[model samples]
Structure formats: structure tokens, C-alpha cells
Target: MYIRDKKTSFALVADKAELDYFHQVSVKDCASATVYSAYCKMTNDCPAWLQAAFWLRDKMSALANVENIKGFHNKKPDSPPKAGEKLDFFDVVEISEYELILMSSDRHLSVLIAINMQSNEGTSKNLTITASVKNKNFFGHLYMVPVRPAHSFIVNNMLKKVSFK
Candidate 1:
């Protein structure tokens, strides 16, 4: 279903209980691209600024003993990723023609990200990205302090850059 007007809903996600945080952003009139393609382009090809942010995050998170995740890089795949496969830091939970769901869990928290594509009147489509987080401990809650606002900025920037050929 389309995530219109930034409505908060976890209808597409299975594990929705006890979510500590949730956010959604929708982009209108997106260029012609499959749901998988759009998600890959938006995430895999990390911009310089975003990569710098991730680098800082990795270094800081290390103090808490969190595993250093392989930050996003320009590694676009040729085909759709399969369920149970790794898509950067997330695990591909589910994927279809119109939607994709990814999850990542650690000792501190579990994060779920959903990408949905809804066809519009013409060639354009509406693309929405939703993120839900469940904090597993005190560190998880603290980790989100900076990440929460940063998430909004990062998603907005990434969505604006998404343009399919």
C-alpha cells in the first residue's frame, strides 16, 4: 500500500511490536524504475557526505563495542537481491515487484527498513521509505539520539538524489 502523507504504519512489516522509533518519507513523481532498482541506487551508491557521516559513526560506535558495519559504497547489483541475502548492512527480509523490506539487528537494537513503490497516473511513481527501530538496551536508546535527526536529513538527501535512467 502507498504510504501517503507520511502516515506511520507497519502493515508491510511482520515484526512490528515494541518499536522504539519510526519514520517515513515519500517522494512524488519518481522516475521510471523498478522498486529494487530504485532502492539499490538510493542506498548502494553512497554520496561523499553520507559516506563521511558513516565513517564517523563507525569510529564512534566502536567505543561501545558495536561491530563495525561495512558502510555503504558504490556497489550496485545487476539483479534483485534474494531474501536472506545481505544488502550492505541490512538483511533482505522480503522483496517483490513493488516492495522490499530489510532488517538489521545487533545487541543494542534492531532496525527494519521498507521501500515501497506505488504507480502513479503516468510514467512516474511514488516512492516511500519507512524505518522502524527497536532498541535492545540503554546503549541502543542513546545511539538513536544523534541518529534520529541524522536519519531524517540522510533520507531526505538520498531521496532527492534518486533518478532512474
Candidate 2:
């Protein structure tokens, strides 16, 4: 997947080798591509580049609090090997990770490991992002800016104005 010069984005589907490394970091992060897409769609605008940025900034700054991951991975064996200890959650599961290429009219911020998957040694396309964001807020904010290319800086400015509000 690749992003064009237009107001659009690409789905970075990694391969098996890349996925292994991505899964390592992804196991900890809470951000999901689906959720991000929905948040961007809320803007009802074009490419959700800016929407993604805002979400990333907020997520990176906020402390990660993930639940059910341990349970999802695999339960430890008890002293007596309790009964009904199976790995069902891991059977049907999904992982979300991506490197958003924020290409604005001027500045282009690449290598943004908001969702891990830092290593780029392999050459496969296993991961994919199905971007279909509708709107961000249920009730849209009048002055709310649409997700654009050059808005990460603006989002940072606003965030700095009110830290963790």
C-alpha cells in the first residue's frame, strides 16, 4: 500500500516476517486501526491523516492501560493444573499496527511508529488497514477542523495550550 500526493492514504499491509516484530510491540499498544478509522470518519472529510495525528498524539502522551491481553495470550499453569484452561481467545484474534505517513502540502512526517512495527528488514505485505472513518464526534464541533495533511502541528499546538484536558 502507498499514499498518493492527493488527499488520501494507503493501507500498509506487512508480510509474515514484519508481522512477527510488529506483533511484539502491538501486544502492548491499545490503539486499533479500526477505531482510528472510525474517529477519522467522524470528520466526514477526506483522507484521515490529521485525524490520525490527533489520535496518535493523545495516545502516545496518555499512559497505556490495556486489559484482557494477558488473558488473551495464555493463562499460566496452576500448581495443580486447573481444569477448563484453554486458549480460546487466541484462536480467533486480530492485530492492528501501522506506520502513518503524514504527507501534508509542505511537511511530511514519516516513520511515525504510533502502532509499533518499527523494524523494516523483511519484505512482505501481511498487515492491512481498512480505512473507513465516518465522523469523529457524534455531535460535530463547529470549529472542529477536518482531518487533513498539515494538521499535526496545529493539533500539537492545541494540545500544548491545554495539556491533557
If scored against the real structure, what TM-score would every candidate get? 0.86, 0.18
The sequence of per-residue lDDT tens digits that candidate 2 reaches over residues 19-126 is: 211111122122223322322322223235544554554454244231121211122222211122232211211223333322111011111112122222343222
- Residues 124-149, candidate 1, lDDT per residue (tens digit)? 78888888887889999999999998
TM-score of 1: 0.86
For model 2, the run of ten residues with the poorest summed lDDT: 103-112
Instruction: Tell me the lDDT of candidate 2.
Output: 0.26
Query: Which residue pairs collide, candidate 1?
Result: none
Candidate 1 achieves a global lDDT of 0.77
Best by lDDT: 1
